[model samples]
Target: MEGLALDTIIAKAGARPAAALACASTHLRAAVAEDAVWRSFCARDLGLDAPLDPEDRPLPSFKVGKRLREDRTLTNYMDAYKVWSESFGMYPLPLVKRVKLFWSSLKGWISENFPEALRTLSKGASEAQIRSAEDDLGFKLPMPTKLLYRFCNGQLPFSRNHFEDVRMAPLGIIGGYVFYDHSVNVHLSSLEQMVEETKEFNLDLEEQGLPIGPNLALVASSWYHPKTFILNCSSGDLYVGTANLSAGEMMPCVPKSLIKPTDSDMPQDGLLLWLEEHLRRLQNGMIKIRPLKTSRYICLYPEASPLCSSAVTNGVKVRASAVFAPEHPYGGHPGTYLYSYSIRLSVPEACMLGGVYFSSCQLHSRHWIIRCKDTVVSDVNGEGVIGKFPLLLPGQDEFVYESCTPLNGSSGSVEGSFTFVPGRVTQPEGKPFNVTVAPFPLQVPDYIF
Candidate 1:
């Protein structure tokens, strides 16, 4: 029995029958043992193209697939995969694959970096649960978002009262940044939470005499932080709550063009695109997990170059980056957009400027030229940043400070220089010289958290 002959027999008789035949005949067993034969069985039976586990790690042999059927634990995993794939069958195969990949990647990252947070992930929501949420919200969710929930229902439940407690609040999957007292860690809402939050928001709007729409749902948010993401089921757009949320104002999270339906016969939405792009950024190292006081969250601030600016002047190294702070309504100013920026300055080695060798530098004052597109908006001249003079000495840790700026427009750039004295502010070693703060964009991102 040749391999091709065995494949033909297996295709006709199926795996169980073929296995029985292999047990009876040595030649047939030899042919059935071929990797290709079991590989075909894996695809036909398990819908797996490669000999790999759920985490995408390789399996020893394709024939190990038979165990997945008999083992109860593995059976549950396979059943979930089948159910999820079947649920989104109307979508393009590539898209279904992409969605699975995103969850797998996210889980892998969380397991390695923050395993405790991994426990927070709930199992996939059932069809009945999803339908219940849809009925409660009085609208159907988009196909992409439906498929998303089918993979994982969202994070675990938490009491509203304990959401702000540092010891109790679970680390959010969509990590946030910290600058002083402000904190934001965003998490996806489960089907139950979605209905509740949406209803609560609608009630608030009604109390304020604002119109309530049936198509809206609260999909994600940062507890104790003002940031909230709302989904418009009819339009397939996801929006971030603006300062005027009570007045029914919002900003689109995904570009309109990117949220259209694909050839998969399924409509793509902002939630799906936003998450995929976010995953891409995480996997590519554009952003990273950051530690807070007693916990950690995913920091939105871009750490890579271009998005993050770095420059060295007279041996004074400065690095700066910024993140959109939608939660910060900026003193109730509806038109203004808020962004938090972090600036780090260090003097790792001694420097010489204008024939003066100095071992250290002390921040004196600062100048910032803020622009929106080509037009200058604010030229700020201030004393010490955040009111403290940072002394930079060789081999010492970098002096870091985070401050925010408001933008009237959606896009802008910040570029300026810092005046530094060669020694401590109390005792100057040389005349003050300028250190550059390289230009970095303060523009809105396509994927809003």
Candidate 2:
């Protein structure tokens, strides 16, 4: 019986007649439960080493083999096996250590990629401050949150907006105050404030009918619009609460609840995980910050008069400035000026830009080339300024574009016009019109004076 293969022996046992079974010879149950049998089965099925002493571990080879045969699901079993193997004689790293390591790596990455933004981060909070905050809030902060504050108290930019006006509160105000200085529409509240507001709104939680737990906390907020990021302190879950505001009243919270679970739409993760994921998204271009207005101006360019057609008040305003680009020059033209142009256009209303045509008075028509991001957009008789056109919104709205053109002469000027088409909703019968592009000087700095 020991020499026989396990499958052969089982087959033989099953093949016994009724009478032979009544006369029952061998201890088949004991044979099946034998250590050797289970060890072989475990090695064959799970590819795990058979334990020398089965009593040493909670999940022995016999139990593992039985589970594998009965369920045949490997995922859960593999996870358990990994935990059991790795944690045999070691304890996991403390949460504080793990968090410190994560912040260190994140800070290093931010410094390398966004040095200006990195400089805005505040110094770490002291242990006494952390304890005081915990006492005031009446809830223990998560280890990761505490660890994060140890590196940076909060990120506030005084002179310039960091990361495109996205500001984060200091540890003290994250749960209590809302930031209104940066935006007109958005407001972020703390956990205590959310709870108080929930009561102030006279919202019927019972009628609202979602699992409104007591563990809700405000993690982050954005004000460009009314959006709030929340975290469930108990379950480590995440939510986003958006409100429809009218006359300072929240329309979205009127009927059912002031705020409800938005599981389907929001990222479901802890605070630290969400921050890490957000940084990753920013790095990957999943997140973008559209510049609201132009930041600077150069006086070297002659401003083109605002061009207007029938019924348009201020038509379209265009401005241009030129700078030297040493990195990108005409392939073989040495001493030839490589001037990069920054152009901005302010549209008065919602309209579509059809195309832009570039012309130069100083450089030859053949030498004039419009290049974007080091790639040539058009040369001389080119079709458009860029491959794709964009639609601009109304009221002091601005759109920016950049292009590089080479000149054979020491000094030259470039001028162009943009084709505009008013939105059909605004002017149902309107046709496209041309707006003058401001001609800016493309002379080297040495010759500017």
Candidate 3:
């Protein structure tokens, strides 16, 4: 054993037996419990330093050290370690303390950085109002939710052009799904309206194979898509629901069908935790920002160069570029200029680019016709760039495709997005999201700005 490598001897003895023997031995206890032996064991098994007192008065005992090492060997523990390592800064405090800290930090940040963007429909909700809303809904609001209402009755509408936008509901209308209440109406939904809407949405969800728990309430909704964010009042878990736009009209005469619920990858501690993480990311520049007002097509992901733009979301990068072929107009039709567009997509993580969609303002307005070879590929109102959709493979980090759009006008533009599907077998119902396509100019070389 002395001549053999430590790992070789350990392998011969086996992990369990060696650990048990080390714990039980009294004669060789001094040698087995040596600082160097425990340090090596800790490093090898747990990828951590052995525990020791500040003054080094008492080293970790064999049982304690072995227990820690053994715990790391468990699959669940390893997974937890990976999450903790990745999210340490994102969630540094426990849920109870974190919620308070988050609200305070958010208030200060908004006041300092976005004071004009902050508008309240009313002062904080009174206890009476909270009780009435809860009683009407048949569920008590979570404490974090209550605390948030105390800060602001509602928030002003700020454009969230990117997929990673963080939007929270005003306390007055926590259960409302419409974005216009914040943007156009500048008012929060009353407690009575919230109850009515939640019940109605829940009924619709039941028909969609995702019946909302009585204790769960809608917290926020995305402006960019038909997705609703929800939180369980009792469990404090967050969930997302995407509308099945293809499911036809929500008419009573229509037959009911299954509509999937998309789960957010955020922690389950509650809305407070989710908001805190997002705000922290924004403060630290981890999140990208697109201006609320812009003349250019909303660049969801800004580009480093004017010719190309890229944006990364959920571990996928979507890049776009364009080339003009003014001399080669489609169908030999004069005034119809040809533009070549390219999408360079990369999915380095465990996700796939399920589909790509391209639409232009000019195209939507019936000003452009797109063609492939000699054939007319798209009418002005076509669904996407190419008539057919293609899937990006799991390990496929790079994909390039070119398409030509023929504009009837001398100058116009084209822009759209890519859809990403997560690569988890267990995530069958996961919803896809759009990675925005930066707008590219299509102009005749002689056309002046």
Candidate 4:
């Protein structure tokens, strides 16, 4: 037994069938999932491998089926490899194309949502000034992403949705153009910085005299910065979406959907397919659904969903959520006081809290959306800026439109039930909904940088 051959040891292990196979030849054991084993370094890798020396490369394809195939050791193990990407969140993620488009739209979405980043960059953007930023971040900027940044920085014609139309239009000016003020500060700086730094770095490329743009555009991320999201423009399709963050989570998330897991429902690999389908169904138009049979469902808002009901995708099913307040439909907070309008949201159940942020504390037993806002009691009236409004749409059925209250962060923090109403829904018996509520709603927060 001490001098036994490898296969002989395997035979003995089969005969003994003991618990100590850990000490035995673990490698000789039959593959639990043979296809998965092959998939780790399959045909795709062979055809399109990164530039590696002939000596460093793996064996190319051999005939199958009729061949008496000899077993070969796996160079890369897929199961064990997954842990490296754990920081990116859950796995078997959405299509790469979607992720790219998401990043592109993300550049735009963040531009749309957070104009502060654009405004700060726009106030003083010059060719050299942007170059310094590129040195800081370490990547080349593409013409399009740059243009969008300029648009955010108030350099071009773009819509600034953050403030009231009357006020924001004047404030969001760039290059003597009104729409240019719609730029985002962070994105503009990042773009300007990328373009400037790369120009010098690619001096070698100029020496080689090969077309230069591909070097800047071909790679998905910057060498200096954490890879920014790149939109998949293969199909000219784009997604409009937002990123949610937690104390410790990773990106290009593998988890099909984000949820506050409960005692009953838990997260698992099976959920990936569900997420993929949900993204596909909402590539265009809005969708609203309430399930009578299932206690839980997913809400997919892939940035392509429409703003109005007529375009809502009828076949798609998603989770319900609430809204954030500030830029209310009718404008300033004062006018919408004590008033209510149905909120249009990705998942309808979101409501105003933290005054400025949206909180989903009512769902799945944890706080979903929340923000920190300043509060001051008014001498003019008992009215202080109560500071939050949960948005609703008219068709939603699970909850009711109730009075708003300021939370001190304690509901015993259990998953509680509530009713939902459409943004268009009205309470004939109570104060008119339209007169009261106008409300509204990132990814690795830029602070991580």
Candidate 5:
């Protein structure tokens, strides 16, 4: 009730606020395991009459008033239950998919409309065979690669599959999410419909006078470096990027050298151009090869630091750019692709990414993303923010992964270990919110898997 940050509390509640607040979110089981106070509160106030609705479950005492600093306790306890249930869940709340849809749509519209960037090939291939297609297509791809590409091409086949799964997700604070398409949009609601509204988007970027005709599908670090991404949407002729959240006209990532893949150092006598021209010829039937000129590769979305800028193979610079897309459509777990690459290729002396494709052969579950810096770790009761490794400050300790056990003889508790480093990200202001929730019983999965 008294330990979490004020900004976090305000973020969880949505909208910027002047009021100071604190909370220690926990699962019903963890709440019981935490202290006798939570158990007594539950027995006396909640589960008193019947099974609890998710939105009406009891939560730990959280102090959220700027003026009434000490009033963290609840007489009804029902408010605690409702707030916690609304904020905490084993699967996502069926609404966060908006983040996925918006991004997927961004990719879909671009790739299909701006086909000049990526070379397209057959879709729905096995994990093993995808490599060949990518090699055939000639570009690294992100998860759901074919899906995002099709969507960009104006086909929305997998749109339903991408949005329907809510099991792997956890509710967000302030529902904090940043988005882009042809326009810079901020998502503020967390509901099924608003989640669906992102897809109905068909705003003519051309109507807005954007570079909708540019056949350049690229992945750049979002103007905002909130989360890393690897994207491949065919950006319209108009190039866009975000500036820090201070709010001004969003600017394009400068040094055009930063985002686009270049062969200047490894300049291969217009190899890139040759590849493009060759692909056009292949499509137009002007030329033919015994097999083809295609390849599967990964796109690294590195930080904008100079260290990231100097990526090379055999001392020759390769393409590298800004951080990952804030809302990557191909699922945001950059590690899966990185780890998979580890199995196939040697680590680059200095590797950074812009985006990747044709890396994995199987269709990925884009719902539960791999752990990222902004991952959120909140308890069922909405009390404390769990801390984790590398995120710790000069002298901070790790919050070991703890169990979520039932309290007061309740039916069950939501539980899992998530890492949080207070000063590590969103710096000088906000921090990353990486969280992992156990939707099913951990014991069952541990032994079964």
Candidate 6:
């Protein structure tokens, strides 16, 4: 037969049959070993555009080099890739590819901006490790979650043993917000970490005489903060622990409808979906990285327009936004909701208020009108903010401060104005005037980041 005819025949016969036929004759072996023939087979079977393994290593031949799934080299680190790739064989190819794309996108962003944080990501865990966790926890992990770890194990927990270590704490991929003494930065837990935390969580519940469900597993938590995320391994839903968690109450992080698979034959889980949605927000600039203290971390607060409100009055501009802090849910008050708002004030140019040119301004006081629905809840006047009066300089960096409040209901709005003098608070250059702080919405997000 012609070479083209022979290559086509071997391709259709599949890898095993072609390998067997290749041994029959030298010509048959040459045709079967052709790179073009094997490449087509690899693409058909594995959805691969290039000949690479799970670790992204180049393969020798598509016929014998069937990625890490069948390559099976038994090293401590490579074993995890083998097991993960094998487990992924059962899922639909499209879903498997999508799961990879999600992690890749997030990792790409981290590598570009926070390369040190990206280096902290652990290698995939072995099947034995995952099984050990399941044995210890007494529950099987959801398939989607299993694949998630298979791509990359959870981030390594930072050691905040010294003052300098405090800088690394905010490197968590699932970052959080800060309000006063309350600080949170959430990161995914490794299988080993999950086993230990779940055990400890159940123990605490047992001590308090609270019911401990066999299906609940602590999968993610803040590095040093009290916040934690729990996964129901059986049902595949994810939740964040609230301030009332010791009393056995938590809030769902993902929407219920999203947890359900579009096809009944295929199974879905919340942790996977949650991370995918988070990546979407990051790429869309809904939530972004912001500086906190001395380090920069992913801030859950919205940065774009609408969700964040901005206005200018008297040549002084104020931009403000709020984020729902689920970890501090209700602040021990079951009926209340907690929100953290960040206010940034700046004078982009020289202040030209009241036809008088001024070089700077100092904040004197603040007036806030908080509302739940349409009813006014709290009207207050206070001196300075967080006990500091920030001075705004012409063409200088904005002065930013974050504070929180507890609302009586789910939905509310905060509108306020700040009193500022044209110069130092001690030496006034002009009469104090109000700077507009536009109203911003406060509501529980449908999809919690």
TM-score of every prediction relative to native:
0.80, 0.33, 0.35, 0.21, 0.18, 0.84
Give model 6's TM-score versus the native structure.
0.84
* lDDT measured at residue 308 in model 5 versus the true structure, 0 to 100: 25
Clashes of each: 2, 2, 1, 78, 55, 0
- 1-449, model 4: which lDDT tens digit per residue? 33235434433443223223433465533331223332332223222122221222332221111223347434432222122123212212222223323334433433554343233333323345444544654543332333233223322222345443223222221100001111111121234343443454356456766444333311122111122222212211111111211111112222324321121222222112222333334333232222212211122211221221111121111222222111112212222311111222233433333232222212111122322132222112121112333433323543322122222221111111123232212322221211112112111111111
List pairs with backbone clashes in candidate 1: 175-298, 176-298
Name the top TM-score candidate.
6
Where in model 6 is the C-alpha error above 4 Å? 1-49, 61-87, 158-167, 261-266, 354-357
Spell out the clash pairs found in candidate 2: 175-190, 186-223
The list of candidate 1 runs beyond 4 A from truth reads 1-93, 160-164, 168-170, 179-181, 261-267, 331-335, 348-359, 395-397
lDDT of 1 by residue, 1-449 (tens): 55566579776786667667779878877776667776776566545687665445565666633444544555322322333345555555555566666787888888987786887888887678888889998889987788788778988656656534454453888777767677778888888889998999999999999888658989998865667899888888899887678788788889999787443554678888888788888888888776666777777888788799999999999989898887675824855778889898998787678877887788999999999878999999999999899988888977878888888877899999999998778898888899999999998887777
Error of 1 at 152 (Å): 1.5
lDDT of 2 by residue, 1-449 (tens): 45466545653443223113324555655455445554444344334364522122445333323344556664323222333333321212233334444555556655665444455456666666767766654455555555556545654422245654443322111111111122222222433343444443323444554344455544444333234445555555555442311112111111122222233322123565655554444345432233323321112222232211112223455556665432232412554556656565665543333442211111111124343434444456443445435454556545555666666655666655655555432343345565555445665542110
lDDT of 5 by residue, 289-385 (tens): 1110131111222212331222222211222222222233232232211111000111223212222211111111112222222333223332232
Best by lDDT: 6
Q: In model 1, where is the ten-residue run with the lowest total lDDT?
A: 75-84
Better of 5 and 6 by TM-score: 6
- The regions of model 3 sitting more than 4 angstroms off are 1-98, 120-122, 156-196, 205-212, 223-225, 245-268, 292-449
lDDT of 2: 0.41
Select the stronger candidate by lDDT from 2 and 4: 2
**Stretches of candidate 5 above 4 Å error?**
1-164, 168-202, 207-213, 216-255, 258-449
lDDT, ranked from best to worst: 6, 1, 3, 2, 4, 5
lDDT of 3 by residue, 362-402 (tens): 10111233434334445454433344344444456465545
